[model samples]
Target: MSVFSARTGLAAALAVAALASGGCTQLRSHQGYVVDTDLVNSVQPGVDNRQSVLATLGKPTLAGQFDQGDWYYLARDSRNLAFRNPRPNAQITLQISFDQKGTVTAIRRGGLDQVASIKPYGKKTPTLGRERGFFQDLFGNIGTVGAAGAGGGAGNGSNTGGGGRDRP
Candidate 1:
């Protein structure tokens, strides 16, 4: 190849590599609650009531399932590359529990270390029933209907006036 064409090919290869690298460095996104440390620190246990907590930290992401006095504030930042699953970069969970009087009793903070991943046991569950193969299931009842009909009429034996009964 000529000197000019060689330099041009090198430049084109470099440009392609730069574009590929750019796709890998994606922007991270902050999802759910945004934590303000100063504001969160302002909430004091035993001193802050439910209303004060709400005013200071705004609303919580989740409330305690069985108890109305508990609140949970969750936040996470995730980074995703091109065509890849987003991975959690940072996570914060603040759990605030209240007393019967609606005053803050306990406050706890956690990070990604508290996260748990659970996997399913299997794809299909074993059920209780007669197990039949594909062909048995498809044609199993084809010849049984006539035999069932000849055996008995599976209906209540109540007599109707239209069926050879006298009516005044």
Candidate 2:
């Protein structure tokens, strides 16, 4: 009945017709990735000490405290939807600590191939009061000055670096 409604209905019908004619398959998602399981199982706990594992596997994907001592091995595949380049998606992790004998007491592994969100690590900067003007700023602190032209001496004061002495 209304013009806007009629136009919307026609557009919907057109989209449906296009789909029936087979044009919507191209819109489906296509994700890319790589999985390295052998590399994953190679560094698990009870296998070897932390230094030995680090020598063989190089480095871990993430090494932080989940509990007392736990390492995480992460192999991920990241793809830019609009580009053809493959990013660094493969990662290995090793959590290590030196005991009385300097040995790896524990280890943990996780094969997280995909992550949707990333949180930045570091201190959060708190908001201060309104900024001050140029002269009123904290960094603009002026020191005690007995005199003003150049220095305690003169030639260097004149910029010729005579140290206030005119060469003969």
Candidate 3:
């Protein structure tokens, strides 16, 4: 075979291989805090306070929402193939509880087992009030605005006719 035809065949093979491998590639992502194993383990309860912990591990990913005493550091590594949702391969959730005096009281660690997946029921959220169609909603208040017992009537009820004074 001539060198030009051979090179064309080789280029076609490489192109096909590139397209095939593209779908097999794994995409990885990291979210939230970046953790250091030694630094996280180095934090000792009763010895480290909020300031010391901040200096050691930097700021936490999230702090206590309500109590303001607990700090949480989260690190997650997720991977996914083409056209697929990313799944967590590894996750670290470190919770450091502090006392009212801002001293570290306890340290807790969690993993992927703690992750919860929540799916909503449907596309449209169910509401409490009566369901009205397009025409009903558009013309729902047609006669209710100035009706007799509904107020705003013409000089009939005490609420509609009287202008800041009581009439006997």
lDDT of 1: 0.86
Error of 2 at 147 (Å): 17
Model 2 C-alpha lDDT per residue in residues 83-113, reported as the tens digit of each score: 3444545443334443444466665433344
Alpha-carbon runs more than 4 Å astray in model 3: 1-17, 20-24, 128-130, 152-168
In model 3, residue pairs whose N, Cα or C atoms come closer than 3 Å (at least 3 residues apart or on different chains), thus clashing, are none
Point out the higher-scoring one by TM-score: 1 or 2. Answer: 1
lDDT of 1 by residue, 63-98 (tens): 987865589999999888887867889999999999
Candidate 3 lDDT (Cα, 0 to 1): 0.90
For residues 1-168, what per-residue lDDT tens digits would candidate 3 score against the true structure?
699999999999999999999889999999999888899999999999999999999988888877756899999999999989899999999999998888999999999999888889899899999998999989989978878777576647455446777777
* True-vs-predicted CA distance for residue 117, candidate 1, Å: 1.0
Q: Give TM-scores for every candidate, taking all chains together and pairing residue i with residue i.
A: 0.67, 0.32, 0.75
Shift of residue 120 alpha carbon in model 1, Å: 3.6
Model 1 residue 21 distance off true place after TM-score fit, in angstroms? 2.7
lDDT of each: 0.86, 0.52, 0.90
Query: What does the lDDT read for residue 27 in candidate 3?
Result: 94
